[model samples]
Target: MTAGEPDLVGPEILDGHLYDYPAYYDLVFGSDCAAETAFFEDCFRQLARRPVERIFEPACGTGRLLYRLSRRGYSVSGNDLNPHAVAYCNARFERAGWDPPAVLGDMADFRLRRKVDAAFNTINSFRHLDNENAARSHLGCVAAALARGGLYLLGLHLTPTRGPRDMGESWTARRGHLGIVSNLQSISIDRRRRVEKFAMSFDVYTPTRHRRIEGILEYRTYTLEQIRRSVESVPSLEWIETFDFAYDISRPVVVGNLTEDVVLVLRKR
Candidate 1:
């Protein structure tokens, strides 16, 4: 353990990093690993004009994607606000010695002396910036850190329509196992703020036990139109493209390229 790393993986709760290792990424991604990797790799191949020699992954939780990309010959540099996540990624990369320092800092104001060929925030992490100013600051920072004509890719979920909040729920019971209720939900937008209040709650069962561990996640959403206004305001940034699902298509529907999330590829204009 490093100076500030937490001791446990699941239920051991790190101060800033996510608890429940191996499971965190799995749950968030839910069996979409290979597809997601291929998506990111394809983006890199196109935007950087080659497989990027050195790349940056901000909010690189657990370093799963970083490790995968590094193995493919890309030098991976990463940073996250969570100390526990940084420590865990460091340990995993130490064996291969490919791990650069994954720093702990504010994503909005991070600085690196060495520039990267490409920079990315994968898996909808950009939406977590919380507000327009933070998002703009982050965009500016990314533009500044890239070498000339470097690529920037961001994959994030589109803001849900703030009209009707649809909530659905389901439960499952296994043999001799505890019953659990999974939450499926949505929230309407706050039209004034161009944000939505998303709410979700889940109840989990212990192994073969019936006690439910419940939690909730709330989010503020940004619609495509809203995001467009913000992206267009930055002088050094250009929104080259957006992919909701597939990166390969001729005259793909740009506006509708959004479902669960949107993937936007940008360049320093």
Candidate 2:
């Protein structure tokens, strides 16, 4: 799908990331699919009661993880609210001669006819729930879809209880003659509500045109206690363990010590 024309300001431009530019989603962020998928596979083997065969991904944009996991011989299915991204993912799978299972569905209220052995919401995608109610609903939906002893691998950076912290990160990716540089920034932090607002700007360079696409990306930040509460509310899921981005299952989560990113491994009861 073609991207919308650039608009630097206003709520209209605050659409979710990749809403307007689904074509660049995989090119810009899916380069590490192999390593990330390996890490997830490790968690599944370590935490799941039975061998994992069926996998599901919520908010599986660009289907990078879905594609990689499928290639590795798992029954992979995914859902994203963005119809365009979902369309692109389905097309990609069909082009590869596989049946497409990706669909347009909201995380807060999605269900499948078949249960999965494991499910995931990686790279801060869980944060997109944006509020307590929505977060609970999404968790409930995921829990309802898991088989007994199934696993849920969730990855995100917890919001610190300490004073404010501002960070920025940028990366560049090129495809043939087209190059795109993306800058991600945390624009607001609401400690009272445990929410953070983000802004992502992408500069696209092509032979005929150069443009910027940017928007607000909000997250419902979770402290350790907050995450515990959220998970506990869904009795079907038991908090199994927490690991830093390094994906070490043996490492313990120290309350006062944490890296910028964490992976929470939960098991179905």
Q: Point out where model 1 deviates above 4 Å.
A: 1-23, 49-51, 160-184, 201-213, 246-252, 256-260
lDDT (C-alpha, whole model) for all candidates: 0.63, 0.81
Task: Please give the TM-score that candidate 1 achieves against the real structure.
Answer: 0.75
Question: What are the per-residue Cα lDDT tens digits for candidate 1 across 1-269?
Answer: 22122324433223322233333433434334466567767766666644467788877777777777778777788888776777777887897876455777766788778888788775667777878899888888888877767778777666545443334334332223322344445545565765544444333344532222333344546677877877887778788877765544232345542344567788775
lDDT per residue (tens digit) for residues 226-269 in model 2: 88899899999998787776655667576542445678888999
Which ten-residue region of model 2 has the weakest summed lDDT?
1-10
**Count of clashing residue pairs in every prediction:** 2, 0
Query: Candidate 1: how large is its RMSD?
Result: 7.3
